[model samples]
Target: MAALTIFWDDLSVETALDFCEYLVRSEDYKLRDLAIWIQGSGGPIDELDGSIGSLVALWSWFKSFREQGLPGVPLGARAAYSVITGRPLDSPLEEGSRLVGESVAHYVFKVILSLDPTAHWAVRAKSGRIAHAWDNTPGISMDGGKHFGPAVGFFTNYPDRLSSNYHNAYAAREAWDDTGLLQSVELLYLAGLPSRPRSTSTTESILSPLLRDDHVGSGHREEIPIAQEMPASITNNGPVSAGAEELIFASVGADVSRLDQAAPLDELAVASVLAELGFVSADGQSVSAVTLLSHGVQVQNVDGFALVETHVAGGRLRGLFLEPMRPSEKEWKSITDAFSALGEKLPAHLANER
Candidate 1:
């Protein structure tokens, strides 16, 4: 069976309502089920606070259908509630509506078939049209019946068939500029269809010429392997050593102590250290705990002196760089509490650090 998918971009609540009305009024479309997936209360409404108003209106409309028995309303009260709350309803009617909407939105027109079906030819042909027109390319024929005009003719005449189908679908399904609601629906339908298999003779016909003795490996003839080449070594006999050997160690700011005996001095630690130093609390006190932690310093290693580095770009360290070395339960709790206290003051500290 064929399916259909409809999509609307940046459509306001008012527009959606009008669309729903149109669908109901139109005699051509026999909508099996309909569901609306609103992004949020950001839809266009006349009232200043239209978000709340639209929800109320939707709710009222749904209530009217449930209580008064409106003639063309497909969604029930529970379905309406689910739409408002953005959650699934437990009831059967609501679940059906939810399934319909979600299926349409994500997988409505997509065709599924077995690996080798008896009616593959017709199914493949129908599916190919949907797939071909999915590219937002204008004028590519949707099927043999309709030709994509000059603007999108490139798709129809594309040299690479596979490349054309892939690109076409991508553009139609995802491209916002050229593809609108109708085109998206058509593309979705095409995608939902099953793929067909090529006849054995057809496959062999396309492959045989390329595999013929004269053309075999025409572009991939075997060649002798090249010998491995070694890079030239640089020789600097004049100054072999600068008299002093420098050892550089790189570690997270929190784990800098691990470098204490490995190197003479630590020049840079992870960026977290600087962020802690500049933190300020709401009561005008410096956030010492956050600062210390950011600088890769903790109560356990108070005596350790290490340079702190951070991941901040532009040659600066602005945040904490402490490592949690097998943190004890108490230490973890303390850290969490410190963060909770510091969270409120983070914005100002971040600005100052910047």
Candidate 2:
């Protein structure tokens, strides 16, 4: 095998530190020698200690690794152990360094095996490869590539690598062996496989006609009390003066009846109603006459014989009006005709009433 060349991506720094600590504690390298090497790396010993402290703090902050589905082992335990024991886990010597470094993956595999000795063949295969790679080249990249190929292969081949025990792991390794590609592809396939469809059942209930009748039997179901109060309709008894091109009318009250009762009219609906009344532009519609009477109510009173009241506070139509009684029979007929035409477009309930 080409000497496994491990390249550590930024994410692998912590893992590398952990592995280094593991090697040191295992007595593979001398701590004093490692310290000396650190000293020789152009930084003062105090700086190295500060750097170590920062790394430890980072590890401590990421203590929720267990919650994120990682093992419960404190992050910097191995490193701390090495420092305390005054041992160098990594060697400056090329061969000894390589050997100790390679053993890191094996140690990890052993730790995993200790948990479940009869781990699946796929797991064993993956562990073996990782151990092999670590022993051969301890500096693997975290990014997916040939450098981190074995780790990716292990995970990709065994989709349940982190979940299920070694059975799936073995299967993935076997598939990878059969095909020359890394096990990662197989793992991807297993992960991407759709789960079985779930079955759903719905039940419907039918009520007896008698029960339906009983439910609506009470006619007093929150009826709005139509008070005997009615506003006096405006009267335009004056002669047809030449300057009187249009007549304006206005009204204010607690109750404003919507022109269309089939469906409730909102502010937009009130605006729509005004547009239909010719007071507003029919083609390029705009809220021409509609004005907020107070923050509590909206009033639309155009310089035509029409007034519409909508309760802005309650956000509902309260009343509508076609005002100014025409003294002439011809004018009355014209007003009635205009109202009838407008009524046609009103909601079914109000249109029916008209």
Best by TM-score: 2
Q: Could you tell me the TM-score of candidate 1? A: 0.17
lDDT of 2 by residue, 1-354 (tens): 112111211112344454444433432222233333323432232322211122222122222221243232223333322222233234223223222223333322222222332321121112221112123322222112223223422322221222233345455444322233322333322432223312121121111121233443223322122212211222244343232222211122122233222233334444544555444322223454244222223232232333333333344343334333222344434544554444454431112112
Q: What is the number of residue pairs that collide in model 1?
A: 31
* Model 1 per-residue lDDT tens digits across residues 1-354: 111111221222343344333322321122112222211222121211211112233233332333343333344433321332233445544344333332222111111111112211111111221112122221112333332222112211111111332454455444332223223323322432223422222111121233234652324322212212111111112222222121222322323334332212112321132234332332333334233333333222221111222232223223433333233344333434443344343321111111
User: Candidates' TM-scores?
Assistant: 0.17, 0.19
Off by over 4 Å in 2: 1-263, 266-270, 276-304, 311-313, 325-339, 346-354
lDDT of residue 231 for candidate 1: 14
TM-score of candidate 2 to 2 decimals: 0.19
Q: Kindly report which residue stretches of model 1 are placed more than 4 angstroms away from their true locations once superposed.
A: 1-76, 79-178, 181-251, 254-354
Q: Which 10 successive residues of model 1 have the least lDDT summed?
A: 106-115
